[model samples]
Target chain A: MTGPDRPHSPSGDGTPAPRRSPWRPRSRQGRAGPLTYLVLIGVTVVSVFPLYWTLVAATRTNAEINSVPPPMLPGGNLMKNIDLAYDQIDLTKAILNSLIVSGSIAVGTVMFCTLAGFAFAKLRFRFNNLLFGLTLGTMMIPPSLGAIPLYMMMVELGWIDHLQAVVLPTLVSAFGVFFMRQYLVEALPNELLEAGWVDGASTFRVFRSIVLPIARPAMAVLGMLVFLQAWNDFFWPILALTANNPTVQVALNNLGQGYVPDRSVIMAGTFLTTIPVIAVFILLGRQIVGGIMQGAIKG
Target chain B: MFKARRRAGQGSAPYLFVAPFFLVFAAFGLFPILYTAWVSLHAVDLQNPNESTWVGLENYRKLFSSDFFWNALENTFTIGVISTVPQLCIALGIAHLLNYRLRGRTFFRVAMLMPYATSVAAATLVFSGLFGRDFGMINWLLGQVGVNPVDWDSGRWTSQNALSTIITWRWVGYNALIYLAGMQSVPADLYESAAIDGASRWQQFRYVTIPSLRPTILFTIVVSTIGAIQVFGEPLLFGGVSGHLGGAGRQYQTLGVLLYDEGWFNYKLGYAAAVAWTMFVIIVVAVLVNTTLARRRWRNAA
Candidate 1:
């Protein structure tokens, strides 16, 4: 059920626009003039300034940061501030915990969502459409609605302060399932499945040998999205895990709420917490942009 | 015999594929939600969640009468409008600009999305520093322009505006990209035809781009509305030590922060559940209203 097909090529990578012919009329999508560049540059600066300031604040002393006309440039105290942040809170443990938690969630969500999405997209089964609709419905449920009871459930299970407490509940994202289902519905072809069945392969066997390979790109995109979400997840993890055993976001929360409120140390922790995801973003920015655009059209 | 066995295997396979998601969701997702509805009907404390006293609609009754509840609802509405309206409008403009053929398109896109990549806690921490009373960058910039250094956290509108700025900064790029995707899908000939008919750039955008992107605009609005209702970590971490209170006057406390306050700080687990449920109801009503409006628009167009 393709809607309006994308006017651009299917790759949808941010390829440079082709050179316009001199004879052609200037349409709305014509080459941008000087004014567009000025506006875009302004927006980009606004976007990146906060993140850049995080680094600057992290490098300065509390007094320097709080002074009138605050220090716009970074100081030489970054390493020392980072060390102080480590002493103030369990920064190392928090980063390690975040890695474990987000890694497990990404892998788990990708695996489970791919399987369920494949079924919803292709297989004929009882209540297939209805179950798919139910999964979509779950996305609309505000996460706070389940927090109190989920917290109580964690308490009963003795999972409070445990990594699994945060990891387990989030491993099955409705959006992940929906995203995969949408991708597979279009990217996968029926003939491929028929060929696998004709070869007498078991469904699971076919899935492993055929579906998995086909789903790799979408899986990678979903994995990155899920990882970023889990890493940045605040509300649930703050509830389920304690400060003693915290993720990056939880540690940042503690840093912000500290009694003395060391601005440099807090900024250092915030910088440290954000760097890994930002690194990932830098390495895979184009793909992630494509993924969001692709998801937007499908969604 | 082989055919029959293969048919049997196929019959059970789809269920096997879907069972994991359903099982996990049943335990962690669906059950907890229904349990929250039940929890709201009782008097439960954070210290002793197991010992819940059934209070019927007492928690709901208290919520209706609570001034804090109304204040939070009002704050949520005001902040939602302030943040979302300007955010979407700016996003539309940025998306329109980005649609023009430009150099370094990838860099522009990735840079604009940097804020989205930043976690709420980190972003809020940085923005709070920028919005600080005496020595903040925003105030410092305003001072250079012959304006007084405004105390960002002192008044209702001021604090709310500060919070809205944080929300807008984080989300505008994201919504712009989504809008750009929608604009890209618009048939180029629609623009060509408009241009042939002597429509200028702004006229073409107003006439063609906006109409073609209605569904996409609606999608972003609905998503942003849901996010606005649950605006948590930004306000929670905005006011330093008294962050959970949203401000000294609780001026910018959203429903999300209020839920945390009722449960964790006040230790009223039951009342918090009631707030959570009420939020769920509001989201549902809002989404339904959006859908109805969209449907009516389509009918009139038809």
Candidate 2:
């Protein structure tokens, strides 16, 4: 973290000072001038406008969306659009399916990655660095490179339309392991594990009680990231899950591409699909931001 | 100094703890990739994959001569450069701005992540509507400026730009936040010293901040390059409703879309695997090149 004179650190007692030029370095509050705020606000509008547009369109009739100057405000047709989307597409089923797949992957990844991460961070084992490096290196291999054989394997196993086809393949995230290991190595002390071992607590017991409890905050961040990724995934879901078993993303795509594509209906479906991740983001904004930055900086 | 001895009980525990990943990764991650390489060398019919015949290098040979393959590679490079350059530049600027103590700091930071957290499928669907030729908001705005409405997804350059816009929109904020983190760690004292030496804001940023952020910049560029090359969902959605072919004339077909097309639609599993292998090679080479260039720059700066 930067010091008091740096940008983010608040001035003691939190009173607004006279406006200063952002170009001039301030020794006090370090607050940005008006110009900087103007630029940031503009950037935020551009960044957020599309989602706003989607919401506007989702709540409006098709004619309103197609108007020369599109309806800038949300309209009264939101429930109507939702009803049409629900009746035409299996919106509820797709959302439920997405929840199941994403939930399983998130929980599974957190548990598995944490266990391995604790071992790597705490225990002294043969080839520990080598194993950890291998895990890190695997991050470079994009899963898409194996699409053909994965589909074939799924076909061979008759898992083509099964949720596990999507879930099982993505459970072991290399980045998740790397991220958790880094956190654990920094957070949990060696003496704690040693104390548990000296007290004749089994390694599993120590990991279950001591490490897991302490590592909860790190796990929550990792779990949120993993869940968001699984929920937003498209290519694999489209390839694995057929029409009968569409995830929310797939279902939304189908709605968008249907024979008589209605913009409001599709937008309604898109809105429904996007809400969960956005809600998660809003709820855990600080943690998610920290998780992303920490992962990137460490890597 | 509390190093527990890895003797009787602890010896196998670490291995047991790590076994789940190895087991799952071998079966799912590593095995399938190796199997794909195996499949790349054979002429495999999707309908009857068991009857795959070894064709050793023929798929590669065909892939090299194929117009579609070359077109896809060209499109991928075109869009990757277009998207990557501006995405990083804009992200750098945004990070610079955010580094200052603005009012509503948390609100702006959280707002920056909104685009990143949205699903690609959903984002693309919204974007496609916006980029639509006739009644789109983009075209509507352009008309106000006395410009004709252009068909975005039809032409090669236009479609590529359209897809690049989608990629840039989704990733810019994420990258900006990363750069912001790097900026925060740049030792604020350096800026203080630079300012004391009577350096202007621009000069201080150019000389001090940029130099300090070299490693972070390199890190982001390499990762972005890899992600850009393997861009899938944007092009896939932009391609059309059903076809994995990038466009009517394969205009915006990236390497990812090409791989999917060859495998699923054409049932040319062997050739698709070749495409996948080729993409993997290109990414590895690109990463190597980026690291070497960045390291050389670091050396020169030092």
The candidate maximizing TM-score is 1
Candidate 2: Cα lDDT at B27:
84
The DockQ figures for the candidates are 0.61, 0.53
For model 2, how does the per-residue alpha-carbon lDDT over A12-98 read when each residue is reduced to its tens digit?
A: 223353356566555322567788899889988988999998889989999999987888999988888988998777888999999
**Candidate 2 DockQ vs. native:** 0.53
**Tens digit of per-residue lDDT, candidate 1, span B103-183:** 998899999988998899999988888888887899999999999989998799999999999999999999999999898
Please tell me how candidate 2 rates in CAPRI terms: medium
TM-score of chain A of each: 0.91, 0.89
User: Each candidate: fraction of true contacts kept?
Assistant: 0.72, 0.65
Give all TM-scores, in the order shown. Answer: 0.95, 0.93
In candidate 2 the C-alpha lDDT for residue A181 amounts to 89
RMSD each, Å: 2.8, 3.8
Predicted candidate 2 versus true structure: per-residue lDDT over B1-302, tens digit per residue? 22335443367789998889878888888887878778999998777666688999999999999999899999999999999999999999998888776678778888988898998998898998899998889999999999999999899999999999999999999999888878776666687788878887788778887898888999889889989889888888776665388888888888999998888788888888899889888999999999999899789978
Per-residue CA lDDT of model 1 for A1-299, tens digit only, reads 01222233543223343555575444347778999999999999999999989999999998898887788899988998999988878888999999999999999999999999999998877789999999988887766569999999889889999999999999898888888898888778888987888888888988998899888988998898889888989999999988899999999998887774677888899998898789889898887777777778744
